[model samples]
Target: MRHYFNDLPKTALTAGYWLFVAYLLLPLTLMMSMSFKDANFIAFPIQDWTLRWYAEVLQDRQFLDAIAYSAFIAFATTVCATVIGVWIALVVATEGIFGRAAIFALACLPAVVPGLINAISMRIFIRVIDLPTGTAAIILAHTVHAVPFVVIMALTRLRSMPKNLTDAARDLGADPFIAFVRVTIPYLMPALLGGMIFCVLTSIDDFVRTFFLGGYKPTLPMLIFAKVQGGMSPQINAMATIVLIATALIGLYAEYLTRRARK
Candidate 1:
């Protein structure tokens, strides 16, 4: 099977890989193009462009507040998610924790479940606990969404390590903390950074959970959603273009980092 997979021509291989890349990029490109239309109607025939949506969205204090709030929540939740995810990965990969499979299954619940379902369930749960329905709820919901991804990212790093390297560190009079600091941490660096960036992206880009959890203040995605629903605007196109650029840059950087790690 390995030989058969490896036997494909390099051009065929490259094309297949780019096929996936194109699939990921196409919608973003379309969204960006649509956002820049000079007219109110979002037609696709390549007309004049304007930055009014960007100006208007930026001018609104509510939208500005949403961006700030989303940044804060995403940063905090990313930290929390990374810590928990890496810890869980370490324990499961090295410590043989009880019912590891079951634990991982539970952790993955948020990812597998529908976003609306997760948001509804979370809203009810938070209400039961008497939690506020605004930024606090958004942060908590984002954390829940981010944890499983962080775990998966960290696990890739953990499994990629050669067992012998860690064992040798331990044998050299280094305890768990010391060995991890000196050896595992450095090797898993790319995965950790990538995971955190991915978590931030997921948190900021999420609309469904944020819509239910956020009150009054809207995140950038929610703001985009609201403007999009009412009617198309040139400035909205401009904002969407900015987001598409940001996403592409992050994904490209992440891909580069992963490739560098392999090399």
Candidate 2:
């Protein structure tokens, strides 16, 4: 009785942790299972498991186009976001340019604001600037949304880096740019890769912002939203399942980089 009482907090914490995990995982499990069912509509106790929906999704031309466009946007957003984020992180971490807190807050404004608000603001900006609204616009909007997260991740990684490495390189007569490229970039790679993964995923999954900001062209998530407006199909489930698997793989890679960086 004494032992049980002494361990009560631990028992409660363990229970709470499992409950939290279940809350997150249960829906995903159900969705994946539903994706496998050979049914026209979504339901639990899925039966007649088959891959027909996946085959259909692959065969669908519009789905393929959406996937291609989404991939392009995600790749572009990752590049822009990571590059800009690393630059911002470097300045904020090292330079005290325009004051660190102000710079960081400016960098993070997109992330701090609600997605809908950011989308609306970008939409207005695009209209005001007379920018051709299409893939470029969507990519720019997504890049804006993704940069802050990358900056935060990069800044955290930068904090852990040896402060003297750049100084040592400079002492060895390396120019500032050369020192940054050689001494700083290698240390930042893992975090940059991690941030890129997240940025890519965010760009791919963003529907609300893309839907508002993207003109004419629809992303994969936007296409899914359009399709679901009519009715839910196993094909959508199949697409979602494929995306889920890809996300899991990328997440694993990110975890690997994070662990390797720690070493």
Candidate 3:
């Protein structure tokens, strides 16, 4: 009786965790199932199953274009965010930097700002600067949103780095630039990889900022939003499933790389 009571809380917590997992995965599982449904409409029965929708989605020219455009934007955002983020992280991590806290806070501000508000502000800022809404504008917005994550990751890694590594590099007669490139950069690789992956994911998944800053060209999310306006269909589910799988794979691959880099 005593043992049973002692284990009760643990059992309950374990059960709750699985329930939460089920809650999250149930919708995704249902959506994936619908992608295979032969019927055009989304429904529960799903008596007929087929790959027609997936095939159609694959043949979709607009879908292809949107995905490609989104990819390009994500790539650009990741590069810009990574460069700027590393610089900020380095500056903040270095000793004797003035207002380090404020600099770090400002760099990370965009992440805490509400997405809609950020989007609205970005839209206005671009207009004020006479920057037209297009791929460049979208990339700029995404970079702002993504830079904070990189700063956080990189800064965390910098804080944990051993001081001797850089000291030893300097003692060996390596210049500051060479020490940073060869010693500091290698140490920061895991964090940089993780941050870059996060940036790519967030940029690709972004909708609000893209919606506000987009020109005539539509991203994948915009394409999906446009389709949803017409109504739900198996094709949309198929497209979503493909995206989910691709992103999941990318995340797993990144995890593997980070672990390897750490080793």
Best of the candidates, TM-score: 3
| Strongest candidate by lDDT | 3
Regions more than 4 Å wrong, model 2: 1-6
Q: Go through the candidates in order and give the C-alpha RMSD of each one to the true structure.
A: 5.2, 1.9, 1.4
Off by over 4 Å in 1: 1-31, 34-37, 44-61
Candidate 1 lDDT, 1-263, residue by residue in tens: 78657867976788899999999888777777776666777667967876666777678787677678878988998999988888888877866578888877888788888999999999999999999899889988998998999888888889979998878999998998999999998888888888888998999889999988888877899887888798766667677677767777988998898889778
Residue-wise C-alpha lDDT for candidate 2, range 1-263, written one tens digit per residue: 78768999988899899999999999888888888898887886776999888899899999999999999999999999999999999989985467898989999999879989988888999999998778888999999999999999899989988889999999999999999999899888888888999998899889888888787878899899999898988888888889899888989989998888768
What's the distance in Å from true for residue 111, model 3?
0.8
Q: What is the lDDT of residue 6 in candidate 2?
A: 92
The 10 consecutive residues of candidate 3 with the worst lDDT sum are 38-47
Point out where model 3 deviates above 4 Å.
1-6
lDDT of 2 at 37: 94
Task: Write down the lDDT of every candidate, Cα atoms only.
Answer: 0.84, 0.89, 0.96
Better of 2 and 3 by TM-score: 3
lDDT assessment of candidate 1: 0.84
Q: Per-residue lDDT tens digits of candidate 3, residues 33-96?
A: 9999988677879888899999999999999999999999999999999999999999999999
Model 2: worst 10 consecutive residues (lDDT sum): 94-103
